[model samples]
Target: MNSSLRSDANTIIERSIQAVLPDEAVRRALSGRKFSGRVLLVAAGKAAWQMASAAAAQLGDGLSAGVVVTKYDHVKGDIPHCTCYEAGHPVPDENSFAATQAALDLVKDAGEGDTVLFLLSGGGSALFEKPLVSGEELQNITGQLLACGADIVEMNTLRKRLSAVKGGRFAQLCAPAKVFAVVLSDILGDPLDMIASGPACPDSSTCAQALAVVEKYHLTLSDAAMECLKQETPKQLDNVETQITGSVRQLCAAAAQVCRQLGYEPVILTDQLCCQAKEAGSFLASIAKTHARPEHPMAFIAGGETVVQLTGKGRGGRNQELALAAAEGIAGMDNAAVFSVGSDGTDGPTDAAGGYVDGSTRAALLAAGLTVHGVLAENDAYHALQKTDGLIVTGPTGTNVNDVALALVR
Candidate 1:
């Protein structure tokens, strides 16, 4: 029965990812739009290669030139017309700097009669980093932010101020040319200007807002990074056509479909679910407690990213934290389980995508001599789940649509 539940959970997650792939959604969105001039394809992220390949298949002979930057292991061979550059992610390296320069060059060379197709997905922020601040400074600030447990939005707010290409600067690079951005949103509420720090979209965030995030997180920035934030650059949003081709809505819909097929009523709690990881987990667990019964099977689904304020050097992501926190509240409840995971199949710096917890989780942990408080205190939910054999490890799903959490009450 446990195996069956795991399989079902995996299926739901996989289907959610497949539903929000940039290539698939972009193709559909572009079907009606007319592009008569030269088509220049520029894509970046963990799914860049796959997105590029899909665009190429749909574009066929229409694509005139192209370039893409992706994470080191994500590149899959070379496209005939597009230059594919593999770069570092989560932390920008020298290769990411070079790739950003190359992408800028490509856009700079685009003519008024050309159409630039910019494919953006999650991880683009790290894969194509051109620092407005020094590389060393960016590295320092990023490390501090990670260790501090700042959420992705807060981290990205600082990133946009530090980056040369982010915050719609990439779109500005293609000034006179018609730029169409196909974005796969991985942020809560599918904020087009926040996903990947809005490389090709207009940023609504101001320098003041960026500074505020740093202050709120109590993050110490390097001198160079601080100077970059102080620079008064007017917000620019012109001649760029930005559209959210995919998002968490796709994931929720997919999960809903699966629930229906399984003869369970699926209630999409929200596609914009956002809050502190542990708090959100506890809230969901409470909701499950009210709904769960022996005779009725129901699935509660939510999408959106949650924040984890790092208090310990534990090896876990927000999803793992959510699952663990929920476990604390639903310890003795039968016929109920809570699962949370990043849609990208990587949560934080850990190999496991996320973890799952049920009424039996507490008993299992105690049997294995694992104390819940110790795990939670260390932010080591991943290890706690591991002891109970509840960690869900799915390496790099190649797509991103934010995070997903499901509460199943049967």
Candidate 2:
């Protein structure tokens, strides 16, 4: 491919990924549904603002009242009908506690025939934090989990037990009222009860399972948090009608279509990819190396979340770590490039969305006196990739479809 064609392909890929936001997909799904009763909208996530806005636009005067909670930097668009609140992510703050309480209050007194619309997506777990334990205790436990590099599922398992609104508690609150959940899945396989700690779905995980997670990671939780976990159990409700509107499968399918439109052979490896970030990266790198040749121009795509067991106090998200790890496997192989990014446009605690790496990344880092081994050991892929201008920075995309990793061979 020529320079112009290559650039066009890259742009197409990025645009296609961005087009699959949860709000857009949810709007499409709700287009035909009609209800006579008043619609009460309640949503929470990094993409909650966008999702709520789209729903409001579609619902128009049909919406009675609404409330949504999202991350601090993720609020976007306008929804005059719904109240929007911003809160901390990865770790819940006082703002999160207040927002969650308000959301619960909004639905607490719903009449038997009232209709409740619940929009859920990634980062909702942190955006609406109502701890069964004390606020300080929840904060400390959250900090410990982040430091330990627990994956989203494991972290949420523990979060559900120690919260007043997580697991199936939210659904139980809206009992007898007709509840409809519009979800943007961020978990591998789009587990309904895992995303956003399954606020509006049945939680299959038990307190015993949550305890196992804490013990497995050696997480030190405060006495209050531990007691909360031991004492609390989410009430299951069967009246909720849940629907997942967007996920990794949707994003990967869109990406594959774009690649095919650009006249490249597109192959989807998996939409449920999970494991260590580095191991996943190496796996992608191996595929790229095998397919990189003059006669074969191919695009391989995979979607899902990866875990990083943090040993080093470095700044990086799973996508950055995956890119850095793949660099080692694809070293010395020309005509191969790999790009991995979170669909949400924010990876971990850092600002950058993700990172891009190629066969030349290793040499570039070494030239700058950066040791890849040391950086990977400390989970500092962001800094290492930043030195080489490999970080893919896109502010907040206002969408969550897990993470997308692509390998291009030409």
- Per-candidate TM-score against the hidden true structure: 0.92, 0.94
Model 1 clashing-pair count:
0
Candidate 2: tens digits of C-alpha lDDT, residues 215-252: 99888887777776675555567778888888889888
Q: Per-residue CA lDDT of candidate 1, range 170-219, in tens?
A: 77788788888888778777777788988777777778978888888688
Model 2 misplaced stretches (Cα beyond 4 Å): 1-9
